[model samples]
Target: MGVDNYKLAMWTFLGSECFFFGSLIGTYMSYRGKSLTGPYPLDVFDPAVTSISTFDLLASSLFMVLAVHYAKAGEINKMLGWVAATMVGGLIFLGFQYYEFSHFVHEGLTLKSNLFGATFYVLTGFHGTHVAVGVLLLGSLAWSAKRGHLANIGETTEVIGLYWHFVDVVWIVIFTLVYLLEYT
Candidate 1:
């Protein structure tokens, strides 16, 4: 009966993320190139920073897998360490997002500017929100482990890992379509 509810939860959340990110992408697509300003994607996007953040999020997924593996091995401390590392990676990505958004706003990409601004910000902003939520979930799990509240470490990590992987998958789409696909 070791079905791992933790992992199960992650799958369920990822299913929802599909629709969530899907809408974001759709909105962005519908509004692209409709900007009435000079601060368009090519004009304002710092692809290099975004590319690095994308890679960091991907790395966090790897660390999350390692954490789950350690959890299954009953290495509680190692599991927690990996979870902490994942959180740090997520934070770094968020920091990058904050900087990117701030830079865009400075360059006149406000949601009120035009359709392009509205869709672009909403889509990316929602993704950022998801990342923030994932960070919270990971942080809570880490805290639970530290406080000895987790009954089945493996199960918990499995669930958290599922969510973590889903987050990474979303970013993959975002980077490919939103960031890199700008030239397309």
Candidate 2:
């Protein structure tokens, strides 16, 4: 398929994912304070740290787009370089996620803690999983680029960038609706 068609398909999939996550987040919002006993979101969440992680994820999107640009131009090395950077960003986000999840669990806010905890953990945890998957995809693409398996680096990079952008947009919503909105 052409790049435009490929992008359309990816976006469609992402649109569906939005609904999936929306339902999860909506459920979490609905049951936010239903837990019998707990440190609530504003009380327990480290908004500062999460904000930094959000920034990191967002920056990765820039690198992703740049990689796509380079690949399209047949600048293989530059594309690979950007892909590697994107993967690093994804890894850093995942590391931050690991720390955050661990901290929450230690604070007695876990998936099984209550309704809020269950919905919150499941939704955000799934997003973290998506980040990990994106990292793997980036790594594999870089590997293929290195080994000469990617005959069209630009198009492949564009496709990956599309997926990466989808991930970033979801985080934007999560950062705003799930975290910041709670405070306001």
Query: Which candidate leads in lDDT?
Result: 2
TM-score of each: 0.92, 0.94
Which window of 10 residues has the lowest lDDT sum in candidate 1? 1-10
Model 2 residue pairs with clashes: 71-154
Q: What does candidate 2's lDDT look like per residue over 1-184, in tens digits?
A: 5547767778788889889888988887788778887767876799878988999998999999999998998889998899999999999999999998899899888888777688888888988989999999899999999999977777777887888888898899888877988788
* Model 2 residue-pair collision total: 1
Tell me the spans in candidate 2 whose CA falls farther than 4 Å from its real position: 1-5
lDDT of 1: 0.85
- Among all candidates shown, the one with the greatest TM-score: 2
